[model samples]
Each structure stands twice: as C-alpha cells, then as structure tokens.
Target: MELPKGLAGVVVDQTKVSSTKNAVLTYAGYPIKELKDAPFEEVVFLLWHTRLPSADELSEFRKRLVSEMVLPEKTVQLITRITYEPQHPMSILRTTVSLLGTTNDVKRDDPPRILAKLLTAIAAIIRIRDGQPIKHAQKGWGVVENFIYLFSGQRPTPERVAMFNTVMVLHADHEFNASTFTARVVASTQADYYSCLTAAVCALKGPLHGGANERVFKMLETIRDTGQDPVQYVKDQMASGHKIMGFGHRIYKNGDPRAVILREVARKIAHETDNDSYFVLQEQIKDYMFKATHLHPNVDYYTALIYHCFDLDKQTFTMMFAACRTAGWLAHIVEQQAEGCLIRPSSEYVGETNRHYPSR
Candidate 1:
C-alpha cells in the first residue's frame, strides 16, 4: 500500500471534539458561525462534554474556572525565577506545565482546574517577563475577561471582552491538529495530563504550526517599517523562494472559516487600538497574495493583527495559541485515556533491510 507523505488524508484515530469537515469548522456538531458568539467558557464546556451547558451549569462552570485560576505560590515563585529575558515564552510554558504536575496536587486534578491553572500560568509568564506583578482573576468576570486582565493588568471594557471571547472560542479547538494529536498520542499511554500538555506545547512551537502567526506579524512590521510596498515585498519574498506564512492550509482549499470570522474582530480591534495602519497593510498584502497565488488567508493571518492590537510581543504569540488550545488538548487527553489503547502503528521498511551484517 502507498501512503501519502506526512500521513496526508490518513485517518489514524477518531475524535468528536471538533471538525473541519468540508472546511467548515464545528465544535461538537455546532457550526462555528453559531458558536463564535457564544461565551468562551460555554464553548470550552461544549468541546469537553460534546454538548452545550445549561444556563445554571454555565454560570457554575464559569465560577469554578475563575476560582481555580490562581496558581500555587510555589509555582509562582518558580515561574518568576525562570521567566527571564533569554528564555522563549513557549519554553517557559513547557517547563511550567511540567512543574504544575509535579508541584501541585495533580492526582485529583480534572480538566477544569488544569485549564484554569494553565491560563493563569501563561498570564503570569507574560507579566513576570515584563516586570509587572501578576494579577489575580476576578470572581465575577468570565474566563476571557479575567484572562485579559491578568495579563494586561487592566480590566477591559465589555465590548473588548466580547471581541476577545470570540477569539478564544474560535481558537478553543480543531479536530486532531498537530498539537492536539500529539497530546492524544501521549494520552494513549495513560500519561498524566501535564505530560500530554507539555508534549503538545513542544509541537506547537514549530514555525509551521502555532508559530506562523508571529512570522505573519513580522512580515507586516517589515513592510511598514521599511516603507516597502506590500505587493513588492510579496513579490521579492516569492522570488527568493520563501513561503508566505499565513496564506494557505492543508485542510481549507478556499479559505479558513475561522479566518473569515476573525477578520472583522481584527478590523474592529485594530481601529479601536489605533493600529489601523497595520491592518491596512495586511489587507494590501492579503489581496496581492490571492491575486498573485490564488491562495486564501488562513486563521493565522488575521490573528497576528489581533494579537498585535492587544499589545502582545510577537515572541509570545504562540504561547497565547497554546493557551486557547489547552482546552482541546485536555479534552482529547481525557478521551484517549478513557479509551485505554496505545497508539503504536506499523511502519514500512524503506532502507536496506535485506542486508545482514557478518561482523560488528
């Protein structure tokens, strides 16, 4: 049998968390367009349990997630010590997740608590690296609101919260993406949640995956700061045989559904934050890329602008991706562990397998 490179179109396992069927993203059978406006906690609950929660259940779930957002004091100390300038945020995050497993009461931990702690820990990494004090999650506010406050050190307006909540909901899951699949493979062995999450973080650090957004922003900054025409920049880069970071995806031939939703959020937030120039440049490049290459923008394209509007450093962008994705990772980990099967697969021998060594 012939197999495609990188297991393209291969079905290794099954999952119900999310799907990009026909290039339309859905979480638990609900279309992404419908869920895009739902509360982030509601969407997370859906991904985990495969159904929407009732009003009272959502309220209680929000409270529980917010309540668990506080990191243990020891974890905070370790984070402060390791979050110096040299280390990448994703590196800090990988070690921190591993530390959470070892330093906390991890034996009784569930998805909600693990998700809450990860959000808090990611925020703490941002703050500590910036020399700002870590902010606590507010009890009354929802997860997205408190998460923004925790990292930015300011409570955002309700409108801002709504925009960010949509961002989180869109990013919460996608069926068996690289990082999610990595988590599942680890979880197939019944490994601990943090171990699974740590492996997922490592996979997301590659430039082709979660790191693409940062490179997208870097391209925008290059065009704006160098005063190069956006189209010319694209031409020159393509001439040099460099792949534009955010133009296409393996699954979405026409366009990414999430990018279609996030474009409006990027526009609104960019204008509100007085970062409209960057968004304008993005539009120019986006139009030229499509006309030049017939490629549509993927989710990473606009999300780079959104993160820039939020005043995040480009280096920490993938860590933010990891934060939203941890929900799906935890869900898959739970599912794979419950299934209780190892994911070992047979490989075809392509080397000189018939040769025998006479002496060594």
Candidate 2:
C-alpha cells in the first residue's frame, strides 16, 4: 500500500481554514479591511452565514442573539453559589463551562442550532463570572453590549460598547488556533458539539494560549510601580532570556493584526479612565520593543490593558477569552463534524522493540 505523502500542510484541514495570500479575511468570509468599520454583530452574522448581513439582516441577527442570550435561572443560581468561594471567577467559570456539557443535554444532529446553544452557555458563564446582576436576553441588546450589561447591570456607553464589539470581533475566530484545533480533533471523533467545546475550553485554560494576557498586564504593572524606565526594564528582562508573556506567536510573523486593533482600544480605554499616563508608558515600551526588535505585539499585550480598564480580576482574564472564543470553537467544531473526517494521526515508532523476551 502506498503510504500517502504526509499531507505536510497540504490544506488538509478545510478550504475554510486556509488563509488566502495578502487577504485579511474574517472567519465570516468577508474581508477584514471592510468589516473593521462595521459593528461586530455584522461580523458574527458573516461568520455564521459566510456573507455580511445588510442593515435589516444585521438587525434581525442582533435580535436572535439578544433573544438567545438568556441563561436559565438555575444557571444563575449555580454561578452565584460558586461565588461563595474566593477562588478566581475564571476558575469557577471554566469549571462551570465544563459542567454545562453534563447538564445541557447537547444535541448533535443540527450543527447551527448546536452552535447557538453554545453561544448561550458560554455567554452566561462569562457574565456570571463578571458578577453582573442577571438580565434576560430580550432587551434588544447585541452580544458585546449584553456581555457588558450582564457584568455591570447597566447599559454600556456607546463607546465602550463599540470597544467591546471590537474585542469580540477580533476574538471571534482565529483560524486553526490551538483551541480551535482541539475542538476539531474532538469533533472528528463524532462526539457531540458540547463535548468538543468543553474540550476546547479545557485546552484554552492553559497559560500559553488563552490565559497569557492577564500576566502581561501584571508584568507591566510591576515594572511601572517600580519607577524604573520601562524600556530598560523590558530590555533587561528579555536580555536575561526571561520569556515575556505577550511577545511571541506561532502565526502572524509580520505581527498580530488583532494586537494593533487592541492597542487602539486600550488607548481609548485608558483615555476614558484618565489612566493615560500609565497607558502612555505602555505605549513607549511597545514602541521601544518594536523599534529594538521587529517582533510586534500579540493579542494578550493589549487585552491586559483592557482588563485593567474594565476593573476585571486578573485571575479571571482567560475566562473572558474563553467566553469570546466560544464563537470560534463552535465554528471549528461544526466545520469538522460536517466534513466527516477522522482526525487521527500516526507517529513513527522509535522505541526499543526487542524486549519481547521479558514477557517470557
């Protein structure tokens, strides 16, 4: 039997996940350059439908998400009970997300409907961790605003809503990412969507992927409080071969595009909080780092500042990432399941094989 060429990056995944040369396409299939100015709801719709919704279409899409955003009273109570502990909300949230699979009775046949269910479960978990009073999803709010409202029980200002929207859009779907790949692997096993999603969240719980941003912020805070020059601080730290949290990536060799957008959002939030000085120092460090080494910032670099502005608990930061990434997780899971391919791979055996005599 011909052992087939190892499919080494042969677009084996799907036509969907492949990146087109020089095109910044969103998960939704629209060019990012165009959607950058649009509300994230539009982007979400595009991801689901593979085309941007018109004004009316977007309005209807928003209504569906708003209506679908509600979590059950039981879920609210569950999250509240977990708050009894001083453990970080993210830890609780992550645990709760895994628990969702056990309780939700996930349906496997219809992928879109399953994705919708995941959207609700993830949003509720995230909102509960943010500690906002419960609000039913019927109030005609978008996902970003709803998430904000669920956290604060108040309407997020227009600008903040836009920023949140930007965050969601940027986070919605990263192509073939670690967590996304994990979801695909699970789905390829013919498991239910919820289980695949739960697995993805579990994958994202690691610090290298979903949870690095909070640490990045903490690092910045430590350096700023020490009253030393941040450039010197970063340079010395990197010189000593200490891995800075938000500086590297497996993709986007040119730079992480999301970081550029997030930096602007961080600056905006900093201006909103009158924390411009701290933000300015951060900016100076970013400039110095980029100038000194051409390596640009990754997603976590600016999300750290966003977390600071939101007054979010540092430990819960990755939970927020998991929440936003549910969109991508669902997308990949459905794509893999629909494609109907097994994800199993083989490894070359390199172990000692003559030990059969030991069995005798």
Best by TM-score: 1
- As a whole number from 0 to 100, the lDDT of residue 191 in candidate 2 is 88
The candidate that wins on lDDT is 1
Clashing pairs in 2: none
Whole-model Cα lDDT of every candidate shown, in order: 0.92, 0.70
- Give the Å error, residue 102, model 1: 1.0
Q: What's the true lDDT of residue 151 in model 2?
A: 56
Clashes of each: 0, 0
> How would you encode candidate 1's per-residue C-alpha lDDT over 1-360 as one tens digit per residue?
898988877888888888888888999999989988899999999999999999999999999999999999999999999889889999999999999998779876999999999999999999999999999988899999999999999999999889888888888998888999999999999989989999999999998899899999999998899999999999999999998998888888899999999999999999999999998998998899899988888889999999888889998899899999998898899989999999998999888767877996
Q: What is candidate 2's lDDT per residue for 83-159, written digit by digit as tens?
A: 64567656666666666556554543343344444455545555565555555544666667777766556677888
Relative to the true structure, candidate 1 has a C-alpha RMSD (angstroms) of 1.0
